[model samples]
Target: MRVTVLLAAAAVVVTAPRWLPARVVALRRKVFEKVNGDNVITFPNAAVGPDRFQEVYSHPAANGRSRGAGLSDLFWYWLSPGPEVHQEHLEAGPRYDDVARTTRALLSGPADALSAAAARCAARVLDETVTGRVTLVRLRDLMMPVWAEYFYELVFGEPCPREARDLIVGHADDVVSALKCTGLRHPARRARLTRYLARRVAAGDVRHPLPATLTPTEQVHYLQGTFYNTGVVQMSDAMAHLLLALAQHPDVAARLADDPADDRYFTRVLDETMRLYPLFGIAHRITTAEIELDERTTLPEGSVLCFSYPDYHASGHARPDVFDPERWEHTPVRESHHIPFGVAANRPCPAWRLSPLALRAATGEVLRRFTLHSTVAHTRSLPNRGACLLVRVGEPLPPRRLARIGALLRVRDRWEHVWRSVVQLVLGTVMVLHARRLRLAGRYFDPRPTAGCRVDQPPSSQENTA
Candidate 1:
């Protein structure tokens, strides 16, 4: 018994750090369930698997009942969930009038609705996702400006103002550094992110960014930098989807292990991979102007609008209703109708290029190298589903190789470290200026015009659960 206990302890000592993050383990319970009968909290959202995903985004075809009437709906409500908004159902107006006439003139065909919609969605994607080419050829001249344009739009909107553009371009490392400088002490996430980004791009896993420079202290700040929100997004979706994908197609792990950058096949695998487990449940927007939707319902200026991504992915019932990766292999090109990035023209996720690529690299590496097989295969919705599969990964590789990998990783990791130090320096400055502001607990001031006003102002109700 003593020897057995010692062996088990030795195994644990040899393994722990390689396969898990402290937060993943801390939130593991919410990520999975022992006896999930009804609703369970996943990630501040109650995902009744995909059903919850569907309900929030679209009307149930049978009765036009909205899924917003569920526990999962509570998440956004908690964040200003009320002002219950509805879709702009032109049925309330002359259904066959202006919109139809306007659409017809451009496409000139009854079936052109599909084409027109596709074009509109394409234009929006171009505005939102595309920037200038930043390749080996374009890196020296085109890259900084390209990223500046994108970052500018990402900031307060509208090309980041000409004055600020200079700061962004000249202070590339400084900007990444500023984010790292938060020092909130969560494993220097940004610093790690830079290293991770470099590895994936170098390995041809995804597109690459321009090179950057920074000092050691700056790197530390970058690691601790502000991730904004996508860090939460990535964690939630990966936890849920990883389990589902493994369970549905047991061999995928092996294939990814053999080659992590098999983009053609693996991309498809993760295509529906995102569908089965989306990073978000739903996104909320308040109606900007009052207009009649479906005629029967009139939204005052304060109405809340929401669109659920999970629902759309989940709703195609016959189309791999379960967590099946093969379905993604043949998954058709989806439009606004099935968006996980949100239905609005503006998507809040900024590091999209890097994020998905990072997720892919991580998933491929872990699945191939470690083998994450959970006895359980489930989802809740709170964390991503409320519950995910509980994985049991293999121990890390041996010391000699480990030492070598660590050294190389460290040298390559300098970019992240330097970037973070610069960010921390900036954050330190911000802190000194607002030392009194920091005195406030939990709530940070937004200084924006409508800082305190209740947004998505619907008639107040008890906070919705999910």
Candidate 2:
């Protein structure tokens, strides 16, 4: 009986992130509707049932006292109740935090340097994918080191500190220690880079914000954000999906390969690719107060709200799922309904401009060299299932090795299933008992606008709709 109870509890805990908050969100909606009467903006299919798929909407007040989830704040692990493994796959932790900080720093610190670094990294990634027996995930894995080196080089310059080198090359075991090295080096390096940028600004060479303006700690944080949290995962996912889409549509691939200089085609391809397979596909928020949505609907304080294109895109676009770049030909690119980088209103991705250009160049390079073949049919889930959509450059892995790999993959899947079930039962009970507290904690970040981003809303006129 005790064992059965434990199992039951785990099941509830595992499922709590979805059902519990959803129940509260629903109950609060009804209560508010009764009290306020008919003004509450009714969310279509807001309640996420056991099928675990539903459409939800959030209305972020364009005024003060409301806040949106930051890039660091929004995540599946934080939003959903699942095993730690779900988040682990997304790299949603301290390591991710470090990477996010770095990426952000690179964005605002040095534009030219950042773009150059990204270009070099793209070239390297393209070279590897063209030559090696590569899959989307494997190519991305190989590109990580190249990106790290270029990033550090742009920041710290050649003959990078031994500690920094050790960290990037994976020689260092402790990520914290590696970060510490960057933490210490950043202050002095930032000062120097700042002075250089100032000179460039004086000469009218630079247009973006100076990294020197940020304190050493802030600079380091921003730099970490750039590579780990933003660029590596999102860009990689976009590239993978683009390759898959191209593989499936050889006609498009041939046309794109023919015109490397045609910027329009490149932009359309990249935009459509991002629309279809956004890596950070979901936008999440936690309500700070009772959000009044047109006087009829109000979201309760501390409520978790989420939006994904897959769920909500149909309201604005016709045949949203069909991979058609021509749809974007007539429509605006930055429509609020289309949030590839993020919801444009509250939390737009800092690397939005850079991500596309880098990806387009990479795509062009890849198409220029080899004809890609899709080994897998579809993408797995959010934060992209890189393993699911397999690709081969030339020859497949040898039969013996392929069998061993296949066996290992099956074993891993089984273990994950068992682990998820066990964890759900164990954690689900705790979650049930403290469901309210969990929802309150699920907000991810405080209720304040993220710094260093435009305050303007997307063309759809939603404030930080992500």
Candidate 3:
């Protein structure tokens, strides 16, 4: 009995660090559940079991009675179970109901309604930002539809049909239907999309080539996953945070307005903004087999592995809470752990490069169009949802400066061409390396079970369970 106790103690010591973050997260969740009512405490190492990936990422069990709800669940599954997931329990929160209700309303309108609504949303965003009369909540509303429409068009090769668009836009409901055991809404949508694609194929009008390997059904779901997981849900979140950063640092905005072509500065600002407020707070991964962390530590095959950006960004830096873009300037070596998207070498977000471009375009447009102003009270609206910004839009750029901007714009175009070439080259290199790695692993263009970790097998259980 004494020997058994000693061996258990030794084992705990050996494996503690490997599982320490997860344990800390579990403890924090328990504490949140106790202090803040409606917190959903997840099962320990939920990402480990093949049965729990949906529960970890999508939490399909969270929807209420509303149709087309819970479609835009964020990526972090560590600190908080999805806002909607708690609805499965007795003590659900208002957030779940709010997301469901809002999504349903947003998606209930006709298909063309979404495209029209997106145009209106874009118009409002441009108007508000140009006038300097916007808040984070308002920004979120304006930008959400834009991303939804973009993803919809990208996936389906045309604007979403009114009915189909409604279902797709209400991500919560779509995700629940796709992932959860609730009902057949998602499956029906997949079938409709598949049939539509088949018709297009038959007519030789297909805009994008369908992957020949996957079944038509699998192809539909694959498109849906690409649409949902890439950057659609996070675009508004990232843009809102960037705007908040700009509001606080108007000098940055001024510099951007004056030298709109200086993408290096914009890249630094973007890096810092993402460092502080990454859209997905945590990234999820799982071990496929028992792995040794060191001679002393071994993790089981089914262990859930999480990378917490908050913890990682907070540690190993000075004044991490402060908004400082200069920290990422070309001064020191970059760390591998400060990943906002997944690791650049492996499972980076498909929208990673595109998102920064969007932010840059939006920032330049707003700065060039209006004189922006905000107060501390307005900035506080960022962390808390539903609060409006206390902002004031001043006069538009005078004709004289506008002419100067036009002249500068010509120079900027030349600079941008050069910059874009460099970016493309770097991106091409990264893609080549990523492709090589995939080929080496024997899973190029095929879905792998472990997102961050590689193992001998691709964990077939998740595909079956999914």
Best by TM-score: 2
Steric collisions counted per model: 57, 34, 9
Candidate 1 local lDDT, 58-172, one digit each (tens): 3222111122223222222222111122111111223223322322232232333322332332234233433322101111122233334332232222424445434334333
- Looking at candidate 1, the ten consecutive residues that score lowest on lDDT are 134-143
lDDT of 2 by residue, 1-466 (tens): 9999999999986765445633543553343234322122222344432122221232353211112322222222122211111222122345334444544554453555555565666566556444545443433444444445544555444533434433443421112111211111122332333343334345533233334434343333333333333344445446657776776566777778788777788778777776666654344445545765446654676554544555544446678677777787788875535556654445457667666656665666566556554433334232113233233435555657655654665455444444433344434333233322332222423343334422231111011111
Clashing pairs in 3: 69-172, 69-173, 70-172, 70-173, 71-171, 71-172, 110-162, 111-161, 111-162
Q: What is the TM-score of each candidate against the true structure?
A: 0.38, 0.53, 0.51
lDDT of each prediction vs. the true structure?
A: 0.36, 0.44, 0.44
| Model 3 per-residue lDDT at 234 | 62
Candidate 2 positional error at 44, Å: 6.1
Runs with alpha carbons beyond 4 Å of true place in candidate 2? 1-105, 108-116, 125-139, 157-222, 334-336, 380-466
The Cα error of candidate 2 at residue 95, in Å, is: 21
RMSD of each: 16.8, 12.7, 19.6
Comparing 2 with 3 on TM-score, the higher-scoring candidate is 2
